[model samples]
Target: MSEDWTRLSAAIRTARKARGWTQHQLAEKAGIGFSTVQRLEGGAPFTRRPPSLDRIERALGWQLGSADAVLAGGDPEPTGSVDAAAPREAGDIGAPPAKRLPRRIEHELASGEVLDTEVLQLGNSRVRMIIVATFEPGDGDDQEAVAEDLEAWTRVQHQLRNMTPSEGNP
Candidate 1:
């Protein structure tokens, strides 16, 4: 086993005991079998199949590197920032911060122009002309408000029969 396993398992046992829970309790909490905890504490090979790391973490109120993983040599963290590992600064140990790079955002807007289109539907011998209604924004407002309105005004075209409607009658 890796040297880290012994250290990690000891850490697990320490954390569990600090909470005043028994091996069975820790097993139940970590979602692993009772023997798993016992083996880990005794530095023996794990007797139970591995459980979900997420569940185990939740049970221990910790973020992985637990007893079973240590005993079974199941957890092997890479030599860099582990994904979702809590971040740290210089002179700070372990993973780094969770701050992500700023995302590029773009705002697009369409003017108050009613768009019309023609569509042909197959299987029913139906031809359709579609009209989409829109409204231009008032002057003197920030582009954001107009952009919001434009976003809200993008409606689907109505399905219409061939040719424009004249007077009444279907």
Candidate 2:
């Protein structure tokens, strides 16, 4: 393995152990396979590369960083400790974003789950669906729903390619 891979491999192993997950558990949670986790730890080869990072981040809820932060009272905190919601168990968040969720989300946003949705027709003849997602500061694990939505969108796009806009079959 390359030096970067070696170091990252060790770090992933450490984080997984720190979270008290067996490789199989982590794999299942990340929506990946057991062999992927083993190869990642061994650094045998980063065959899946970038997507692997997404899976790992999804399984761990948060990824370690190297930034430094200062608390309100002037205490310098270590980097990689961006724990916005400190939950009791590892990855026990109510719901988390997808492993491949777009990180460049704009607009000041918050995380939530859909409790209700209502469709409204606007004055400008545009219709919008207002979904109410119940939320608190997230514990940040469990990306299954987001993953499912993403997969659904992908299928929608594929279906769209076979249709013409004039066909009323939308």
Candidate 3:
């Protein structure tokens, strides 16, 4: 079953344009890089990261699996909107639960740089963390440092998961 990249791209592009959004705007709303939106709109290829596609689907107000349906020569299904203030619970029929905002923290370093972190709990025992570093003006190349810092945290998390009770660490 080959996927129709052209069909998917056209659907996404048409939806985005109908919303009067630029590629950059869609990328920001989808929490992805701008080039990703370009690639998708250009029918370059499907993303290796499946979560990126999921994010794009949600950002475009499409129901889950709408992208796959589109690639399979079907139209995207629009998601029914749920009020953020509406009282809802898990397993509710019809509409999904309202989205929750992420917890954010910001710290200013002595060098006048700022680090912002957002923590979102997807479900029980599953959390996603995003870190953004804002260097002072004229500091053009600190993203690698931020990525290294995030990698270090990932390593620490794995190490902690591997610890046993006999190690005398909780």
Per-residue lDDT over 52-170 for candidate 2, one digit per residue giving the tens place of the 0 to 100 score: 55556646655422101111112222335332333324444323335334332211134544433334433334434342334333466468865665576557545644544354432
lDDT (Cα) of model 1: 0.47
C-alpha RMSD of candidate 3? 17.9
**TM-score: the better of candidates 1 and 2:** 2
List, residue by residue over 39-82, the lDDT tens digit for candidate 3. Answer: 88888666442446666777788886788898888999888641
State the weakest 10-residue window (summed lDDT) of model 1: 100-109
lDDT of 2 at 88: 26
lDDT tens string, model 1, 56-108? 34455654344445555554333342223222232332111222211111111
Q: Model 3 reaches what TM-score against the true structure?
A: 0.49
Q: Sort every candidate by TM-score, greatest first.
A: 3, 2, 1
User: Model 3, poorest ten-residue lDDT window?
Assistant: 82-91
Model 2 gets an lDDT of: 0.49
TM-score of 1: 0.33
- Backbone clashes in model 3, listed as residue pairs: none
120: Cα error in model 2, Å: 30
Best by TM-score: 3
